[model samples]
Target chain A: MRETESAAEARPYHHGDLRRALIDAARRILETKGPAALSLRAVAREAGVSPAAPYHHFKDKGELLDAVADEGWRILNEAMKAAGENAPSPRAAMPSLGVAYVCFAREHPALYRVMYKRSRDKEALPEHLHEGEDSAYCRTRDTLIAAGADPSDPVGLELATIAAWCAAHGLAEIGGFQQFAHLKEALGGEEAFFRGVFEHMGVFARGLND
Target chain B: MRETESAAEARPYHHGDLRRALIDAARRILETKGPAALSLRAVAREAGVSPAAPYHHFKDKGELLDAVADEGWRILNEAMKAAGENAPSPRAAMPSLGVAYVCFAREHPALYRVMYKRSRDKEALPEHLHEGEDSAYCRTRDTLIAAGADPSDPVGLELATIAAWCAAHGLAEIGGFQQFAHLKEALGGEEAFFRGVFEHMGVFARGLND
Candidate 1:
């Protein structure tokens, strides 16, 4: 009996581990085939498990996708936090965080798309992740407040935050498109192009402070 | 012979009009089902034509999509131009153009998504629409140059253009997502929310000028 239990544990199918395995498989599918191609059966096939195995963990594809998006937000929040922590000051952290935001989108285009699927139904999002309180959003807002924006003026603060957020998000989405290939080539390479954008972001950030 | 030709034209199967019909059908499908759900057969079915009919007009789905995206850009350029032309001055035109951009995306989410599909291959885009010379992109650049950015400094002009573009693009993309529904509600409604964003863009534009 002891040998059989140890064998089951060593087989990588131990109880409660299937959920994590499914999410990992889903991320792989999302990264490679994109959200449109993702399905529970595909994830199960990628995980080398029976289709019924995923059903045991997720109620349906939406539940599984919600889990994937949840994980994506968590990963993004960590990346933004790390970028802020590594920067020299709150002022510098602003653009660094913006760079990190765009870089995250570039690295995980499919996952990022899935994370922001356009359903127009807020219920589709996981309950714990409120957009206003999202770690990254709050971090950006706090940075703006620290940089001399009037914290008491809610509208002013909101507008400042939106300006910064919009600029970063726009760069990420547009930069991801192929239409800018010529501009990227002219700027030397992708990294060089992003560097130029980041430098401009520094100016935009200072503008916000003023 | 004249009567027969008139009859054929009235039948909605006019020889030269199939391409236009197919494109119109594709737009209906795109607006209803979105880009992910778009397919050649579905477009043909929507047009009440045989499955093979679309092939006569478009070799493949990519060709059809390119056509749809091309139409999207032409419409978007016109919208931006109208917004700029109606504004009182170049500075006023900046935020008007930004508002028009976000409003365009909100009004045509699916078409906008198809127009900016994330293909890293430059060949995917139509050759005529050069990124640097794209009407909307160039218009934004010219507006920035007109707003006091030194035209002599190419890099400065480029960065300023990018900052403005990124902010507008970000607002459009982010506003399309449901996560910001609460923010929209808090600001009163969609128009009110957009008004707030446009107001912020005005401030950011002044910052750029400074």
Candidate 2:
């Protein structure tokens, strides 16, 4: 970082800019070097602030990472909501959310890993994390209910929502991440894979009708 | 670990048993403390062997963890096979395998986490892991084929197998490992949860038939 002194010097953290600078730098480092590479000092340096500056906004690296993940979920919720809005029906909406999830995981592998894979330090996951989670679940749950699921019974609703989530999540982990990129195309590619699962799920939805 | 010194000292390494002793020690530590607690020195100490002794049997911690995971998969595969063995029909065996999977994960969370959660280090996984994976897949795939599904096409078989695996894994993670455990009795419990999912899936399957 010191090698690029001029770049650092040009970007001093102004009163209102330090926090945003730190978050942006953290995201860059997370993308280029992954969550393990994230450090408060590094973020502070990247933001052209004294090492002490990040402490003003984040208590520790975990808090910063948590904020990043929180932001990620928020971003993900928006993407899922947007995609679901375009679907012709609630059943059609389901695959779009599934695809959107896989797409987000693929696009933000590092953030996704920190958000879900690592045992999150609660310091990073604030109270708002639940709100983000609930919002995402609401998108899915509402789709199921609209498509004829009985939301009054939490049992079936939760089961189906979790099933779709795990399918998408496992597929993303097994395909979208670097570990299994080699198998992605063969795993019916992401689009076909999700469509196939959702199509199968549509078959399962018939039981609700019965 | 030091608390068990007397027991450790009583059972010396090469009493026609060192390998099994080390394996047992690894499992014990893993069960109590999860994978991060696994250490060659610790296992050696627990087994009453010199620190260097484990290298003679397992190259490193990843190798040791892989071995433990393999062992877990072997047990899981056997349990799954046993579930299939006495089931009434091929279709019955499929959900039985799902039940066995959930039961195994709930019964041995640590072992299940080690088996699936840990990033598979290729240098450590060897053919045994793949063999175990194939064994589990074939157990379900063959059953699906016996139930009159086409197995000659790889894509169809992969989809069904993965879908089934995802359902079982999702159920276990949500029903056993997640906060849903607290809601189990009130939420109609694991049996009802699985029944609802599979029943819906059965409806979906019939849709494919139509």
Candidate 3:
């Protein structure tokens, strides 16, 4: 089996694959051994390449970590979009978007923490905050707009988006408390509790009776 | 001024005052030099005491940090109480409770981070989460109950409490972003912006039209 796959495996060290390979290796190290174990040399080792090989792609550990964080954002954005799209309606998508956001943070705690901690110093909204059509903020904003949130009042729309984002983020921050274990179970486990809270918050979600 | 205050300053080295003095010094160091610069030795120097003085109260840097964090919790609780009490109505107090929560995080970010980071490992709710009538959680819970949230449905009340807490925590997490400067100004300022978001989330706060 090893002999048959060797040819395909050898492609990892190729110029185009090395960066992606290194990032993938870094991600594994991040989840398995935690952030402290990550370094260019270690990533190179994990990628099964020569120690100097990572230098061709990432100039230093910071660059490699940045690449890893970028990957986290991409995946997180996709998760939010998928969760939103799976919802029955645009009105319901708001909570789904929040639930997915918190789920992403819970699933990849180290990567999630590192991702935002880096952006925090920038004193501006990170890329996920309404920068483009695919950005998480815009997705949330679009959902709210579809749900009959006022599109004309740009400031009102932004505050409403912040309200929803902050609710998800705040839940992620302390959602793991054992005190909530009973409530979470009672509410039909974590996702239900999240959707419940999101619905209860209901920035534009006026149809709880429905 | 020094000649008059020397006698009062002399009180800080007293047994009870020494511990408080050390925490105050640590707080100053935390804000000025950041967490990396903290050590029992550094705190002793900041407190203007013998290098060995901190040992009498705190056995290690960790103990000293725990003490500092305790002081932070006390201050945060007081802020929440004041905010809740100041609100004109029980319904409005929910947002007020959240506003003060975020304000505390903003005013003393380093201490606030240290406080919660230590609690994160416990996998349980922190002391402020409905442990007593004085705790922040109960204050929010009591406010909600006063405002018509069902006390008999303890689970419902608990979920509502969490929603409000997370909103505040999440805002504090990213409330410093410069992107909100214009909105903050348009809302009449930062506190107003916080109130708006909190009202928008409104957990059990359905009277947004009010």
Candidate with top TM-score is: 1
Model number with the top lDDT: 3
Give the alpha carbon lDDT tens digit for every residue of B142-185 in model 2: 76666555657766655666566655665555454344444456
Candidate ranking (lDDT, best to worst): 3, 1, 2
Question: Which is better, 2 or 3, measured by DockQ?
Answer: 3
Model 3: per-residue Cα lDDT at residue B64: 79
Candidate 1 accuracy as lDDT: 0.71
lDDT digits (tens) for residues B25-109 of candidate 1 = 9999988887766878898888778888788778787778778888988888889889878988765766677778888988898
lDDT of 3 at B188: 93
Return the lDDT, model 2, position A53: 80
Query: Against the true structure, candidate 2 has what lDDT?
Result: 0.64
**TM-score of every prediction relative to native:** 0.82, 0.76, 0.80
Clashing pairs in 1: none
Clashing pairs in 3: none
TM-score of chain A of each: 0.78, 0.77, 0.78
Q: Which of 2 and 3 is the better model by lDDT? A: 3
- Per-residue error for B104 in candidate 1, Å, reads 1.0
- By summed lDDT, which 10 consecutive residues of candidate 3 chain B come out lowest? B201-210
